[model samples]
Target: SDYSQEPPRHPSLLINSKVPFNAEPPRSALASSYVTPVDLFYKRNHGPIPVVDDIERYCVDICSLIGTPKKLYMRDVRMLPKYNVTATLQCAGNRRTAMSKTRKVRGVGWDVSAIGNAVWGGAKLADVLELIGIPKLTCSTQSGGKHVEFVSIDKCKEENGGPYKASIRLSQATNPEADVLLAYEMNGKPLNRDHGYPLRVIVPGVIGARSVKWLDSINIIAEECQGFFMQKDYKMFPPSVDWDNINWSTRRPQMDFPVQSVICSLEDVQSIKPGKVTISGYAVSGGGRGIERVDVSIDGGKTWLEASRSQKTGVPYIADHVSSDKWAWVLFEVTVDIPYSTEIVAKAVDSAANVQPENVQDIWNLRGILNTSWHRVQVRVGQ
Candidate 1:
C-alpha cells in the first residue's frame, strides 16, 4: 500500500493490480488526445517501486566491455543536451485479454489500453555515447560486444533477486536515428516514481519492456542481456508448445511488435442505438514503422471503411518535431449506419506492410504475447 509514493492515478484507469501497481487507462479515454496526460498514462511494473533517495546522488553507471567505464550522475546526464520525443509506449501484452479468450496464456490480463503517448525529454543515447565514450562493438556471430544492456535499480522477485533489465542491439543504442534516450522527464515534468523518477531509458519504437525504468547501469557487451526477462520471458511460442514441451531458447526475444488496432469504444456485448453509430480508437505499429491506415468493418470483414487518421496538429512545439515516422499513435474515428446486429472489427496496416492477423487463433501462442490480431467487438444495434 505504501506504493502510494507512486502517486495517485486517475480514478478512470482500470487497475489490474495493486502493490507493485499495474494498470491502464479506460479504453474510451486512451486515444482521446495526441499526448496522454501523465495521470492517465498506463503503468506496468514487475516489482516494488524502488525509491532512489537523494536525487542528487542518483547515478547511472556506463560500462563498456571494450572501453573505459564511467559514472554519470543525475547532474552529469542533465548537463548533456536534451531532446524531446513524442512517442507511444505499449506493453507486449496490450491485448492479451483477447488472446486469453481463445486459450489461457500467462501474463497480467491487459485489455487494449495498456498503451499511451507522451512527450519525453532527455539526452539522446547517441549524443551521450559521443560525449561520454564509445565502446568497441562487434556484430559477428562469434565475436565480442555487439549489444547494449541495461540494468534497473529496482530488485524484483520475478527476476529472482535481480533487477528488471533489458537490452538492444549496439547499433540501435548508438545510431542517432534510433533516438534512444535517458529520459529524465515525462511530458514536461520530472518523472514520477511510478514512471521511474530521476531517470529511465526511452527506447522509441520498441516494446515498453525494453525501456527499463529506474535505470541504474548501461553496459555494452558481446551478448544480449542475460536477465531472465530477456531470455525466459517476453517471447512467443507456437500454441502447440505447452509448458510440458516448451523450449524457451528456440524462440527469439520479441523485439518489434506487429501492426495492431482496436475499437476502443463500442466494446463487446454493448447495445447501441440503431441509425448512425460512431466508432473510434487507436492504432500503432512497432519498429518505427508508422501506421499507414486503419480500416473498420461493421458487418465483420466482408466490408470496410477508412477512418480519419490523426493528422499532425498545426500547433508548434515538439508536436511538429515528430517526423513521418510518427512513432506515437494514430487516433481514428468513423461514423456509419448500424441497422442491425453486427461485429465491429478493426485492423491496422503499418508502413512495413504488416497487417494484423484477422483472428487471435491465427497468431495464438503459448505466452499470449504480441496479441496484434484484428480487434472484434460483437454489439447489438437495436432501438
Candidate 2:
C-alpha cells in the first residue's frame, strides 16, 4: 500500500492544500451543531497519510528515556474499555487569516473552519498506562520527571524532522481529569483515512498538534519532546522578530490556547437581507476552561447583544461534559438589525475570563498561531 495515494474526501470540504490534503468545511456547514460531522471535519495533514492496512503488524512501541520499555499490540489496546469523550480539536493556526491582515506571516493561511468538535471514542490514556505497568509517582529521589512523547508515523518537512511528534506532561496525560485517549473512532465511526484511520491521540482541550495523527509509538521521557513540531514550530514569537532575525529555538511550544471565537454565519463583504438578521458562529477555549459568553456588536462595539449558546446535551456516550467546564465547542446565535452597511464584531470570554483581543496588532506574532482577535466581518444591507 503506497502512502502517496490520495484518499477520497467529502465534496463539501473547501480544499486548502492539495497534495498533503488540508481542508475545512464551509462556514455555514460548521454552524450545524456542537459535534462536527466526521466527513465535514477539518483535515490538516502535514505529510502523506501512511497506508495502514496491516492491522496485525500495527503495533505501538512504548519506550522510556529513564525506565524499561514495552511494546503493545492493537489487540492489547482494544481489549481495554472504551470511553467516549466529547471534545474539540482545533488547529493552532485556526484564525491565521485574521492575523495576516495585521501583517504578513508564514505558514498555512487557515480561516476559522480549522476548529471542530466531535465525540471521540477510545481507551483512556491513563488506563492504557496502568495496563502497561508504568511506574507510579512517588516522593522518593528515584522519581523521574515524566513527559509522554507521542511520535507520529507520517514524515514531515520541518527542520531536523523525520516524523511529526509532540508531547505533554505525563502528569497531565495520566490524570483522569485531562480525559486523554488513544482514539480509534470519531463521531461514533471508525476514523476516516484523512483523520488518522488506525489510531490517533486525542488530547482534549489543547491545540490540535498535541494530538498526533497516525500514531506510531510512545516514549516516556524525562524532558519535553525534542521533536521539530514540539520545539521549532507551533510556537508564538513577538511581532518585533522578523524572519531575518528570528530564532526558532527561543520560544516554547504552545500548550493550552487562549480564548477564541469566530463568526461563521457571515464572511467578509457578504451581502445580506435588509432589516434584522441572525448572526451565528462557534466559540471554544483551550485547556478545558470552556467558553463563558459570546457577544456580538453590529455597529462597531457601540451596543451589544448576548448570543444564545447551544452545547451538546444528553449524549448517552458522553457524560458530565454538558456543564460549563465541558471540552466541546459551543454553537452560538444572535439577531441584530442591519439597517445599513456597517461593521459586525464579536468577542468571547473563556471561563478564566480571558477575553478575546479586539485588535490583532496587539497580539500579533511571527507564526500567527493564536489569533483570537475580535472576529470582524463586513455586511451590506441588500436583497
Screening candidate 1 with a backbone cut-off below 3 angstroms (N, C-alpha, C), the clashing residue pairs are 145-221, 145-222
Candidate 1: tens digits of C-alpha lDDT, residues 263-330: 88776778988888789988888877777788999889999999877745653212222544367787
Model 2 agreement with the true structure over 1-383: per-residue lDDT tens digits: 23457688899898888866889999889987777898899999888888889989898888854446777778888898898998889999988877887798877878889988899988878787776565333111135757888998887777333788999988887887788899999989988778887899999889999999888898877788998888878888888887799898888889887888888889887898788788999888888877778899999878888887777455321213444437877788898778888899988887778898878998888888888889999988876
Model 1 C-alpha RMSD to native:
2.9
**Model 2's TM-score against the true structure:** 0.93
Question: 284, model 2: CA deviation in Å?
Answer: 0.6
Return the lDDT, model 2, position 92: 92
Supply the global lDDT for candidate 1: 0.82
User: What is candidate 1's CA lDDT for residue 314?
Assistant: 57
